[model samples]
Target: MALHLPQAASLPFGSLTKMLPLNKTSSSVSAISKSFNATTSLKIQCKAPSVIVSDQSQQVSRRSGDFKPDVWHYDYIKSLDNNYKEHAYEEESRMLRAEVRVFLSDTVNPLQQLELIDTLQRLGLAYHFKSEINKMLENIYSVDKFKNKQNLHATALEFRLSRQHGYDIPTDVFDSFINDEGDFQTSLSQDIKGMLSLYEASFLLMEDETILEKATDFTSKSLRDFMSRNPGHELTSQVKHAMEVPLHWRLPRWEARWFISEYERMPNMNSNLLQLAKLDYNMLQAMYQEEVKSNIRWWERTGLEEKINFYRCRVVDNYLWGLGMKEEPHVEKLRRVIGNLCAIITLTDDMYDVHGTLDELELFTEAILSGKISVRHLGLRPDGTMVEKRQA
Candidate 1:
């Protein structure tokens, strides 16, 4: 990221002896010539005697090729560099500010906030966003008047983003995102995002595998219980498939979570899901390895697992999109390999879930149940929007 600059020009000079000659006898003339030769020798130092003085254009070319401009010396250069860096920072800050403005402009959810934070991180501006989110949290939490508001839950995005980054989010911050006056059902998708972030943060922020395992085990059980009890739902089949299918054909939650308690219980006993998830993770790791293979020496030198994990997130997210959760498109030319890596991981996750299902859950019982598993909701029509169906 360093800026390149050209070199300065050398001062002009003339042959000292040419303009000052002495009239002399042979001895004096010889002495004069010897002195002149000595002076010329000293001026040249170790350089070859025939070295050419550069022309204006040649000097320019030499400066351009062989030297950088002294950016530190020029007031304008220093000013410009500082201003540009600050401008870039401000541009990112503005984007985050606009995102917050949108959050405040209408009803939003923790999910949207999570999604936004994720976006900021991907865009390399999360640091600037951290302060903006903090200010919003403070503004909302400093008064009881706003505490009872429904829009508070929408702002939970700030709380979750801050919490996930281990950025000191107070309980009051969480309080600001919840409605004191209502039953707390605001944005379903955002709620899901908040729940997922909470689940992830418990593991992510802690960095203790034991804690993560306990959290994972608990979430697994709770999710399973929810799935098991909610049988005969359309989403069950979709959920079952998502748990088992590869990314390209995987189901969205509306289609996947139709069956209730199976998600919680069945996958635990089923080795297929565990293996599939592992396989998907491994495949993603492999693709990441290939990505860094050319720089394997560099990666080993730096111990860049954070970058590796970040890329894995990308793979998982892409798989989610391949399953119909369209994420924002990333257009870096070198990173196109990420899409392929995700495709493989998505398929593997589905296969794992499929192999891990309980015998009873695995058996498609729609015909035998005689509409017991069929959804009778208004949005059950095939042409209905997935978002509407999910809300239903």
Candidate 2:
């Protein structure tokens, strides 16, 4: 993220007789000429310099995927309406979530409270009730739930969520699971719920957490074994999924998008909560797609698709990456800027890798740094030779 702006006397790419300074030493006229000759010599080493550049423009960037274009139509995406803006929908969702929130407040059983809290989080409704959730966790910690555990699932859930929210719950809280033989209690593996909780909990491990590291290994193996024994069981799909990507590591929007369907299938799932999640997810997707369309418009206006063919023209992927970084709907314009920046950076990487020769790269680097060459100043001749433009 270092931005260097150099001092300059000229604004076009050519054989520089002198270059003024911002960072580098102010070299004399002869020295500048020598540097220019050296750059020419570098390009001369390549066979058919412009031919190489042209050939490279035809080559695919290493990072470019061969995937086909996305099938999502803009009109179809824009047509999606989750009714989240309507008064009735909002109040209904709020009331349903309120039931869960009230349940969180009224419960005396720590296990019951933590289970509901965990469920609220996985359902993507926790963002609406951070204060209640924090208070609940603080109450759990105040009771010293970390030190003693009557239930394995409850204990592991507490430890995982505590650490996740930066509670500094030591990894040794799990030491009880290990036996005198320096291994997990073999009997513990049989409790499918406990094993699954520990399996998800293990993903919260930070660096040098030996106990959690071992816990991860233990839980993973146990869950796989449990899956083998309980084929086509109710928990089979969930157990398999947990092993693939623990909840902690999953991307938030993607998790919500996925959990909406999974939560709908749950036997005792709150219907209002499911509707809210679906509305929220669809609304966000529509916002993101709108931003994406703006990015496509920006890209097309630049005519980069026709002009720059060396890199991946993944406009949607660019927007998604920005969304992954910061997906809040209020920042649609910011996401658009980030999307364009991402796309240009990807294109630049491809240009540097194959098309931009050393001389061209150095010249552009120095020129760009020095606020020169605002225009396309370097062009390739038919025979693959560099021609520097002299601006009028």
Candidate 3:
């Protein structure tokens, strides 16, 4: 729960250079040179000096990532079925969306409106009501009026949502909660909901925002103390989750998956919102399954997974990464493109890290830099040998 900002680690470049296989006389270099020499028609020129292989015992040893086999197989992925994709469900979803829109527009209380907006966002339904949410946030920001200045939850929620949507809310808004000692009042610690709100909002702090810096320390400590003291409290679970990873940093799809279950347990949860979240999530999950299946087919067609045995077969994981980047259902094509690229990149990275010797890697890098290695010509054998793939 300690709030530590990320810092880049300095690599030991000097020591790394000493360990590189730059020696031209190394047996690995000779092995690679011999491998390249065997494929004369392939047109790959090795950077290492060629050595005549009098003995056939010499072979380049490849490293393995030791990664476990993927548990999600093609048949399992294809079997994933959800009724939410049907037209009947679509009509129901549309009607529920309309009802939610009315509810958003009709909410008169500013705090209630902010809470609703926050709920919509966490539930991953924000995209469906983007315009309405934008308009509501604009009115809220422009008015610059809150009935209760001392209300920490309202203030923090407003600050977070507004700043998140590009509004420059000043950090001084929390000054009222500070005492003569220039610290958040001790009494505020008793309000678990407010502490949680402020904890999340503090992440929106810009460079040199000392007030928020103080707020982060105060709220984190207060929330942690509350969790230790009241472990069985209803809000303890939430505080623990937020402390582990703040809402701002959580993955949207994963967050929605978690919040949907949590939202169901709420006493005052809206039935329409809960139903829409579940249906929408299922529909999107169905789409994701199909997209991953398509990408896996594409990967199989490329033959990289078969041609290169040293790498990980992670088509589903790559698709999940792509989904994380663009979760909107309408961006299926973009997601597929991202998934394909991620797959290629992952394979290439593993090749460089686990299989390729320094000489081979350097030659490959040079070929790439000189625009000599095209996708059509690039091929590798199981024995870490490069070969040319002729067009059929």
Local distance difference test, candidate 2: 0.60
Local accuracy of candidate 2 as per-residue lDDT tens digits, 51-70: 22324665532332233333
Candidates in order, TM-scores: namely: 0.24, 0.72, 0.79
C-alpha positional error of residue 271 in candidate 1 after TM-score superposition, expressed in Å: 40
Clashes per candidate (backbone, < 3 Å): 36, 1, 0
* lDDT per residue as tens, model 3, 79-157: 4453445676577678889999988878978889999999999888999999999988998898976534989999999
- TM-score for candidate 3: 0.79
* Model 1 TM-score (2 dp): 0.24
**Pairs in clash, predicted candidate 2:** 50-384
- State the local distance difference test value for candidate 1: 0.32
Deviation from native of the Cα of residue 318 in model 3, angstroms: 1.3
The local lDDT score (0 to 100) that residue 185 gets in candidate 1 is: 28
Cα deviation in Å at residue 13, candidate 2? 43
Worst 10-residue lDDT window, candidate 1: 11-20
Ranking by TM-score: 3, 2, 1
Error at 186, model 1, angstroms: 25
